[model samples]
Target: MAYLTQPDYVKYICSCGQLKPITSLYFCRHCLKIRCGFCICHEVDSHYCANCLENMPSSEARLKKNRCTSCFDCPSCFHTLSIRATLVQPRQASTEASGDAKVENKQAKKMYYLSCFNCRWTSRDVGIPDQPVASGGWPERTNPFTTRMNQLLEYYKAIALQEKQEKLERERKKFAIRGKYITLTDKTGLTGAMARNIAGLPSTDGGSSSAIANFVASQASEEVEELPEDVYTKEVNLKQITSMAQRLASPEWQPAEVSRLHPLAKLLSVKRSQRCRACDHNLTKPEYNPGSIKFKIELLAYYHVPEVKIISHESMKPGEKAALLVKLTNPTGHEMTIKLLQPEDVPIVEEEEQKSIEKSLEKSLNLEKDSYSWRAICRPASYSALCRVREVTRDFTLAQRDDAAEYDDDARHDADDVIVWRKSNKLALRLEVETEASAASGAPARAALALQYSYRNTVPPAGNQPHQRNHTLYTTVLLDLGHVI
Candidate 1:
């Protein structure tokens, strides 16, 4: 069993030169390389409310400012607010009778109020009336600055349209030097807002000559409202005042006193998908449902790469050789031929297409040497962790992972020099490490191991390549030794 508090003793070198644990790394079958978060692209797949498990389209979410209409959060504690029902009894008057004719109804009507279980806060505490319906009947407060905000939004939209027009006109002249093509905008009588509408952009102030002509500037007052006289003499209570965080949570009013605090609308959560920047292939895509914990497509490094675990190791001393035991497991269904190589002896292979990417990056970087290129440069100086380690090479073959093999107790023993034991798809190897004579005492003796293994790529017929499958891949892992005694 793995402990949550344990340190990351083994780290893999990502193709983007980042050193990350297996949990955070992803494997791209198309590129046959390991990728990290820094070398991938993320895009929003869906928007949802975590509290209510409600999903909405991105366009609607944007229009609503990414807030859930039914779900609410506690203004005091920020916890999810639950609907609590209350009963009320009132007298009803007969429609055809005189003013004195009234009927008493003991039957009660149920109303719902938002309540926070964690903080004992309720909607009635802030003077909000109970809702008739539990889900959608809650009253929405109008923003005091709504009119001004709408005016500003339209003003900016008009300005953006004007700038887009100027940019297009400039680009047209720059490209029209061949004198072959003329745009419909120049031929038709459309102008200003109409032309912007034809280009799929917003109309400019509904054909107004200028936005400033319609915009009304706010007036400044010379007189100021003074605070109450009791404010200076009254004793301050910290509990009655809202904290900075509570004020910022509801920015519309930003009430300062606890009495003015109201229930906050719950912010919506979004599901995102990540893609490899190099190949434009999705690395991870989650299910659209908010309640699901699974993903539609997940390419984690742990599933593709072989896992290595330290079993035991002898104490190390300066200028002495020590024995190290490590167990390797083949996670893939296909048999893998694993070869261990020295850190510096491993070769990095790139396709002709990827090589061109390097030249393009170099051109963008002004041909600076030693400076890291974009996606083109994967293995960086961080891989030098292996260069500091000294170890011998070992080669072995692991069987394919079989579900029925786990039930068989009998183990297979190999006669190889490094093979210690074999059970199913796992192989335990006895590795020897030699410490430097001049190595400082009490310093950690690090060891680096590179694995060149056969991988059966299952990514079928992606883009133009239909037969690109089965390849040899290289990955480097680093281990930390306690210290030289």
Candidate 2:
């Protein structure tokens, strides 16, 4: 078991050469390889409001600027604001009726306003009026530069479209075969104007040209504003002044005083799915419903790969052997045959397989690069030279996992020179760790070992392929022993 406070003593090597704990790695069943977060592609599946748990379409979320219209966050503390209601008694108005004074009692009505439970801030603090109905009745403040910003956006979009059209026209003219006769209708059935109209691009003759001509660029000002003479001498009230976080919470206004701060709309959260970049198979896909915390598909390495835990180890000394006790557990339902080998003994076929996978991925993605750029950038440096794994030339079989066997205390003592004891699906192995003579004192004593295991494929074979249930897979793990003495 991995401990939260302690460092990772054992780390499995990912297919991308990244060393990660088994808990953090993912197994791609289709590719039959280990994958890490750095090598996966993440896609946003859906967006929803965390406060209200209301799911919204991607287009709608984009329209709302990825913020929930109904839910709001407190400007002072940036906490979720709750709607509070209070009864408001109506004031009685007396008028001269038939030269006599009359009094009438009015019924009380409930009014709702936003309040933050964390900071005890309310809409009334900012002089915002309460609404008769709850949800979405609060006023919205519009940016003063909204019109200018929209104009700038349109101008840039038109400029980009104009450039694209010019490039296309140039390429077409260069490749066109001159015809003796000019036909009214093109053979492709899509004229330039018709294509532009279909793409919602402005006509070449007017739309973009007019937008470019009408756009006015802003001029930089040289003048600087002078601060008030009492700015440094004035007694400052820290409570009344808004902090940087509070001001940034409502970025549209960025109010310097706490009284000018307004409640901010809650930002929308997205549910994302992680896919293996090489195989394009989903490793994890969460459910679409915002309220559900479960997943539709979760292919974690913990369920498929064999877990290795360091039980105990002796102190390391240069050019000396130390006793190491490790527990290996088969997480799969089927029994597995495991063989321990030196890290260098593992065949180079695995690297060839990775290259083939990368080729396939590049072909599918139409990418010029051999593989994802992150794989090359994020690979961890190897530390296998610090210590060496002693030769163990025996294979052992681990039984399938049984939940009922966990409660039983009777562990089988089918022990050997390497095997210490055995339980259901688990085996404790006593191994020898040999440190290098040249290893520096106080440096970490690291050893790398490879495991060749038999894995049963649960996924059904696709197409006319033979049903191969069991396949041999190899994985390398690094062990961190104590510093050399």
How far in Å is the alpha carbon of 240 misplaced in model 2? Answer: 2.6
Query: Model 2, stretches more than 4 Å misplaced?
Result: 1-3, 163-191, 194-206, 349-372, 378-381
After TM-score superposition, the amount by which residue 303's alpha carbon in candidate 1 deviates from its true location, in angstroms, is 1.2
lDDT of 2: 0.86
Measured against the true structure, the TM-scores of the candidates, in listed sequence, are 0.82, 0.88
Listed per candidate, the RMSD to the true structure in angstroms reads 5.4, 4.0
lDDT of 2 at 460: 77
Return the lDDT, model 2, position 170. Answer: 87
Candidate topping lDDT: 2
lDDT of 2 by residue, 1-485 (tens): 44578888899998777889998999999878888887677789999999899999999999999999999989888899999999999999887899999988888999999999998999999999999989787898889989998999889988989998889778766766656223444456578788888999987757678899999999999998999999999999999999988877777788998889898999999999988876688999999999999999999999899999999999999999999999999988999999999887776644555565566556654433535575465444466557887878889899898888999898877647888889999999999988999989999888898999999998876799888788999999999887999
lDDT of 1 by residue, 165-203 (tens): 789879877876453657665555455667687799976
Task: State which candidate has the highest TM-score.
Answer: 2
